[model samples]
Target: MNTSPPTAIVRGATVRFGDVQALDGIDLALTRGALTVVTGPNGAGKSTLLEVIAGTTPLTRGTVDRDGAVAFVPQRTALTPRLPLTASDMVAVGTWRRAGLWRRLSERMRGDIAEAMERLAVLDLAHRPFAALSGGQQQRVLIAQGLVGRADLLLLDEPTTAVDARSAELILDAVAAETARGATVACVSHDPRLIDTAAVVVPLDGGRIDQSIRDAGRGRPRCPA
Candidate 1:
């Protein structure tokens, strides 16, 4: 069994928006190279959990420790429409945090962008305008962007939404590939089938984890749900 501590840890997390509790006393551990699927009914705080993991939302009452760089793909596409950038350009943005304005990208950085596109099978579309692709293609491009910096933690919110079944499968396959390469992934989705590909399954209800299942193939047996 892999004995390493989790790459990301959430302990007694809680979030509230007025009277409604978005998240309540949630605790989770995402191990390195592990794929964890977050599934539950609507209004279950799945998205809120991903947001906290990515550092987009501050915790209301507890703690989240994200040890390495993190990446996020929101449920809605966040591409800049007026930027007139290509798909490759979008991928390059991942590195901008390291080389902000007034900095030039090194050849090595450029190579990483190229490799990311190729890994997602979007190399041919590298030169395509970001706004010219369909929903699924755009999703893949965003994923490539997220991976450009070798982000250790990736949080995807409903990545398969609006895409065809085949496209969704492609994205899931790529996610599996990322996890195999030592990136921890937490994906929020309404689809329960994704549980099959995950090392752990977390089910949310009314803002808290209702059940947790650790896949038996890699880790010690978890208490029955």
Candidate 2:
């Protein structure tokens, strides 16, 4: 067991959009450096849970204690295809916080972007316009972008959607790389292969987690209250 502190903890968290409750008192502890897969049926609020973990959505009730920077890759539909930026340019956006305007990318920044793209197997698409790529390709680029940033918490919503087996493996490898670097990875997924890589499996239904399976290899995980 790593025995390190968790990356985030949700206690009685609730998120309501109109009458539909996206997250209904959801509670889960995202273990540091461990990959957690969020599984649920359609309209089960899997996306909403990721948003809450990313801190992009305000909770309607209860609390979320998050520790450290976050990187989020939303669903493909959330990615804007209208941008004229190339795939690399889109990935470089993750480094913009440090590169900023007028500041040329340092060697480290350039390497980070390259490594992220390479891990996602999208390096060849670096010069291609994001909008011109296929949906699977665009998803890979978005994942590359998310992985390039300095985030302790990685929240990816259905990262493997439309991705081929090889591409999906590459993405999983990238997520593994992030975990090896001590980041907590949380992904919303329906893919069964990912279950083997996860330290915790949370299954949601109608906006609430019905059960959570802690990986036996990690011993028993203590989710803080």
Global Cα RMSD, each model: 3.1, 2.7
lDDT by residue for model 1 (115-155), tens:
88887778899899988887777888888888887788988
- What's the distance in Å from true for residue 180, model 2? 1.7
lDDT per residue, candidate 2, 51-111, as tens digits? 9888889999989999998888999898665998999999998876667856899999999
- Cα lDDT of candidate 2 equals 0.85
Clashing pairs in 2: none
lDDT, model 2, position 67:
96
Question: Deviation in angstroms for 127 in model 1?
Answer: 2.7
Off-target runs (Cα >4 Å) in candidate 2 are 100-103, 212-225
Clashing pairs in 1: none
Could you tell me the lDDT of residue 169 within candidate 2? 83
